[model samples]
Target: MKVTSHRDEIRVSRLLGASRYRVEKPFLSEGVIYGFFGATLGLLISFLLSLYFQGPLNRFFDPVKFIESDPFFYLSVAALEIIGGILVGYFSSWLSVRRFIKF
Candidate 1:
């Protein structure tokens, strides 16, 4: 009985005309671009969904109107919008990188 090494086996298989496939390297730029695009799309989708929900949400909590009428309303809304945008951007970017990156 003879023991065959892994390399030897591969060589023998190739010699016997076995079909083999080569793996290609992934491009960094392509992945980066894809992630950027996906993140943008995700953010837009999230914003739209938020808007749709906000209509009903405001009705349920009319206090929002009162809050809006307050002097600080503008500042508060601005802060919220900024925070929401950052959150959406980060979440979308993360998902895109994790799900679409070949690496």
Candidate 2:
């Protein structure tokens, strides 16, 4: 049995095709993943809120004001939220792996 040490990050990085990509790919991918999560989270919250409020607050859930007025509005909001989440993930990845790469 071959045992790999945690310090073998370099070897692992190279095995991933290249050292730079090892961190770059994860950072970018993590961002996209988190962004999708954020977008879904926003939509889910909106849905739940719509269901929770039945009286005057129900107006807040009107498709005329929120969903129908502009389809692009929802897309943009989701995109923005996704970007935000991705940025955070990217920053976190950078911070975590910055020290691991030597060249």
Q: Which candidate comes out best when scored by lDDT?
A: 2
Model 1 misplaced regions, further than 4 Å: 1-26, 64-103
* Per-residue lDDT of model 2, residues 1-103, tens digit only: 0112333755676787775765457555766587678767877898688677755665665655544368788689777777787777666656655555555
Residue 5 of model 1, lDDT score: 24
Residue 26 miss distance in model 2 (angstroms): 3.4
Off by over 4 Å in 2: 1-7, 11-17, 54-56, 59-69
Task: Name the best candidate (by TM-score).
Answer: 2
Question: Cα lDDT of all candidates, in order?
Answer: 0.51, 0.63
**lDDT (10s digit) by residue, model 1, range 1-103:** 0112234654565577664421111223344455556555666777689889987887898765452377487467655655565565555545544443332
RMSD (Cα, Å) of model 1: 13.1
lDDT of 1 at 50: 88
For candidate 1, what is the total of clashing residue pairs? Answer: 0
Q: List the residue pairs that clash in candidate 2.
A: none
